[model samples]
Target: MTLFAVDIGGTKIAAGRVTEQGDLDGPVLTTTTPATQGPEAVLDAVAALVRQLDDRGVTAAGVSSAGVIDSSTGTVLGSTTSISGWAGTPLSHHLSQAIGCPVFALGDGHAFALGEAVYGAARSATSLLVLAVGTGVGGSYVRDRKTLTGSHWAGGHFGHLAVPQAEGLLCDCGKVGHLEAIGSGPGMLRWYYRHGGDPRLLDARELFTTADADVTAAHAIDMGAAAVGTAAGGLVNAFDPDVVVIAGGLSQAGPRWEQPLRASFTRTLIPALSGTPLIISETDAWLVLRGAAFYAQTRKDIA
Candidate 1:
């Protein structure tokens, strides 16, 4: 059976037709998510994309989004500044009503972890942690092959962990010294700019590219890697996950960040768990959408 999946991000909305085995059947349709748009607009955008797939006979829909989602009720409890008016919105009910089909809402990080566990690097592991480091850092923990959505469905907000650095770094969540303040792609770039570094000509990709050939860029990459690795190590020690998967745009830095990240993780792992492995995603950017599709397939009652 084919399921329709929608991945909603701060900047874009992507939709595709996915088979039961998580194979995407056609080119994904995408549209820019306007910064000023409210939750209604976001819902409309998702509905339009799902309708396109529905026209092709797709019935079940799964949505992965960057916000606190109440999966039990299909509502978006809250979101970052990128998506306004999402708080208290009944996203699942709206989408289902709009498309005339069952719809499931999932946190983007949880969906990404599910995708990796089912089809990507973490497939063999029963307990895993998946971290996506993009515009912001997001994480999800899977144990016994089940995604853990804590009370209030806000379990994976790991990026809010306090950083060891001084308490001055501001996070978009209106907090200071959070992990995302120094480790996320935007956070890293912002840190560089604040430290008298010029990143005007660089996005996260170019910054990592420059890191390979420039000393200053390398330092920036190292700092970012250290922050990420340190956090991963602490998480590993605390949770003792069998595997940790890194996914998202920053994973594209290749060895520029991966080596340092691994080194930091190794330095931080408890002696007993030093043998644990960290797997970097091969196809980081698309994992969330694939996972959403996987979710749609497994929840057969939704179809």
Candidate 2:
């Protein structure tokens, strides 16, 4: 089946046509997310973009959004300051109404996992754990090709998992000591700044670029990787996933990040769980779009 897929992020909203064969039918389209203008404006922008891709052949639309989503109801149950007034938005209902098609909605983390499971690196695995470490560390667990969205649809929020390394740091959710406070890209930058890194460096990329020679940068990277690894190891012990896939911006940090994360993960895991493979996602650009399409296709019966 052909379906429309939308990825609504804080920075941009992307859309494209998806095929049942796990690929895009055409070029992906994008627009700036009207996050500051509130939910209605964001929805309008998304609907407009989807309409641009609309053809009689498109059967439905699937949306992957950033928030603690209630997939069953296609609602945003919680959100961060990245998008103002985003929580409590009835995403599926509104988008479906405006786009004149059935819409399925879920959090970005879940979408990433689903996409990987169906078409990316973990396609061969029966159970998978996905960690997307970017603006914040988002994650999801997919078993037997199905995402495990919790009762509140907040499942796989790995960033919020508390870690000793992040103790005393404030998280975006107003909570203290969450993994996002130390394990995310921004979190690593904050660590660099607080621990005597160059004050002029504003981007985490710059810090990571110089980690080979900069002590502070290396330390920050190691700390962040360790925190994430520790958390991931704990999660593995709890769930015993067949594989753990890492995605998002930080995954591109090369060996500086991956090495330490792998070290910490291996150290933290029990002997039985040590064999679990933790790898980076093989797919990019179209990951979420394909997952969104699959979500809509599979969950069409949601009331």
- The C-alpha stretches of model 1 lying farther than 4 A from their native spots are 54-57, 165-167, 212-214
Residue 159 C-alpha lDDT in model 1: 84
Local distance difference test, each candidate: 0.80, 0.89
- Model 2 misplaced stretches (Cα beyond 4 Å): 301-303
Which pairs clash in model 1? Answer: none
TM-score on alpha carbons, each prediction:
0.93, 0.97
Question: Residue by residue across 30-57, what tens digits does model 1's lDDT show?
Answer: 9988647788888888888766764466
* Clash count list over all predictions: 0, 0
Best by TM-score: 2
lDDT of 2 by residue, 1-303 (tens): 789999999989999999877789988999999889999999999989988885667878889998888887899998857789999899999999999889999888898889989999889999989998987998888998888988888888899999988999999888999999999988999999999899888888888778878999999999999999999999999999999998888898789899999999999999998899999876486799899899998887454
Clashing pairs in 2: none
